[model samples]
Target: MCRSKIFRICLLFSAGYPLFQMTLRLIERTFYYPVSEPVDTFTILDLMFLGIVLAAFVSLYLGREYSDGVIRNKLIIGHSRMSIYLANLLTVTLGAFLMHGIFFLAMFLLGRLYGLPMELGFGELAPAALLGFLFIIAYASIFTMVSMLTASGSVGPVVALIIAFFLMIMGISIYSALSDMYAEIPPELLADPGFNPLASRPKWQQVLFPLLYNALPSSQAMQLMDYVAYAGAAKAGHLSTVVIEPTVFPLLAGTSALYDLLIATFTTAIGILLFRRKDLN
Candidate 1:
């Protein structure tokens, strides 16, 4: 336990502390919009912070599993790999939850100091706050599962990043399928950018690309951007002036949780079942 503590202290400084610093910078640069109301959706800081936390946890999970042989021999006690996985999950979730709770407290006090009409009512804000916590945790878990399966935890972030690449590629690949179907429509309507979701691609193609994009967990960043914007705008009371809808960000976040669960379960199940039969020699 003493060794685990010392090792974690080092790892936190090496990876996690840098992530927190990045989040601090992100909060300063990206969360600078004028006051409108209290928090509602997410901000760039929120999304980037989530990614930073996810990446940090993934890296460490992989690092720990890789170092497991040494830890077991040195400590004269070791858990089954499943125990290791669960303990890591709990540690990541708890640490992030506590840190974010403190972050929210700091943001609230800062908002109050600035005389912003930020809502502090637990009844009103608790659900949203809880949902955000769950969303990040779910995202982290998916990244962790991927790290364990890849044999190189370092590849976790790259795989998560590929979701963005998938979106760009899938979008271009199906643009032709969409244009061909929409060619029969009125030219003026088809020409309008606002009509593009349906007009740019047939329903099937639209749904297909979204599926491919969703398969990449990082693709959820596109959706979470709306939540971040809403959180900022809500804090500033900018929502009233905005004509656009709230975009159901919570639902989208929930969908991300589901996607991560489905994929992670499959990946971990395969790895654990395989691990039981393997021999390093």
Candidate 2:
């Protein structure tokens, strides 16, 4: 399963990346947008595509095991349910890592091939990538829990996919709203100090949103990609303060790691307890 699964994942990305690049290039030539570069075009592909791909892979993978009675057989052979769950979790985590690694390599290769400007050096990119990696593992853990908990193999994938999609949407929405919170005060608003919008908000509202936004796995992905986008522009010496301030880099990276760890730990614990009592018959 491991060898074949890894091969399938590699094949998916190998075929997918070139086609994605072509589509982006076609869009660039046919349509007009401010940004034009391979990396810039390709960086955010993971934001949506990663979850979709992983959701599909994980659901189908675990679902198949149940349908084929592999889990039942393992249990009959005296393999503890806990071991089965952990083993599958570890395998899927490795698969997720491999998938992301391939995508990352492809992005870099394509970036160089197309002469895209990369503003952030390894110091910046490394941390962002690490946080993003943690988010992916966390995502995998949650997907595993869902996949295992569902009774129908056929329906499990669908449920997991829905969950993945919902979280992605929720994360993006929260990130956008929180980002708006920090938008520069308008010149007109500055003149009317009494009309300060941010000042009107409760202290907890200000603190809670960013914390919630950062808690989401999707936000980690968003922040990582956004960081790359800003870094690229800065490298080209075309920084845009109005649209996005890169000052959130530290905050994004730090919170991403913290939240991902907490969520992953929580999910794994819950998954083990639930799976132990799940009736295989």
Candidate 3:
């Protein structure tokens, strides 16, 4: 756990934060006609940026040790394999959270400059924060497992990043499909015989959508982003635009956190068990 390296990564994240916002602002100024809406600071795009940064940093940080045989030296000295893995897991998890914080700090500051409202109230945002935190831990656990499994410096991070982006894409697609189910069908549309497509779906599909959404970390992040956007609107005194049910927040947050914890625990346990028996050579 080298503090200096972590600090350097954080500094890079801090720099990227403003660059991201500036890009969005530039888009609003140059492309969006009449600047239709405030730039959504709390969004799925945040996940993309943070995910790539953390994935690359964690992979390189751990991969270097494998390339240099530092892990083998640690094993020979007396340090338990479990401890080494856990330390790396903790380091990456904390680093992910720190990067998120730096981005949010920039978000709030940037929002103020544009006269944009805050994206979430304390009450509404708490559950999202908790869910996102669990997700970070889960991500760290899986990435750490991949890093430990691969011997090459270049392969681990690339694989982890690919997996991260793939999961995020899947989550977003699932959420969008489910969102169609939740949408209220207009009476005129329902009256059309050909428009009964949604009604024709099996009962099990309806039952499975929320369960699947709550189980995926990326879906949870997406849901949280949506809620934050609504909350931001409400905070800005446009409460009428907020359409999501109040109960949905607690349910999604609770289930997502539970799922993330289970994943983190399972991945860590498996990683530790495997690395213990792995030949360092």
Ranking by TM-score: 2, 3, 1
Q: Rate the local accuracy (lDDT) of all candidates.
A: 0.50, 0.71, 0.69
What's the CA error at residue 8 for candidate 3, in Å?
2.4
Off by over 4 Å in 1: 1-44, 71-79, 116-125, 150-196, 199-204, 212-245, 277-281
Clashes of each: 15, 0, 0
lDDT of 3 by residue, 1-281 (tens): 54557457666766576667656765676677544455453523455445556667778888988887878788888999899898888887887777666665565556556554344544555455545677787778888888988866889988989978877777877777866654665545644557543465787765676666776777777767776666667677775522223336667667777888888899899989998888778
Off by over 4 Å in 2: 2-11, 22-38, 117-126, 187-199, 202-204, 242-244, 247-251
User: Mind giving the per-residue lDDT tens digits that candidate 2 earns over 93-130?
Assistant: 88777777666666655655555555555455555555
TM-score against native, each model: 0.58, 0.82, 0.80
Alpha-carbon lDDT of model 3: 0.69
Report the Cα lDDT for residue 245, model 1.
26
Which number leads on TM-score? 2
- Give the Cα RMSD of candidate 1: 7.3
Q: What TM value does model 1 have?
A: 0.58
Native-to-model Cα distance after best TM-score fit, residue 46 in candidate 1, in Å: 2.6
Which RMSD values do the candidates have, in order? 7.3, 4.0, 4.7
Instruction: Please report the TM-score between candidate 2 and the true structure.
Output: 0.82
User: In lDDT terms, how accurate is model 1?
Assistant: 0.50
lDDT per residue (tens digit) for residues 151-175 in model 1: 4535655775454345334544444
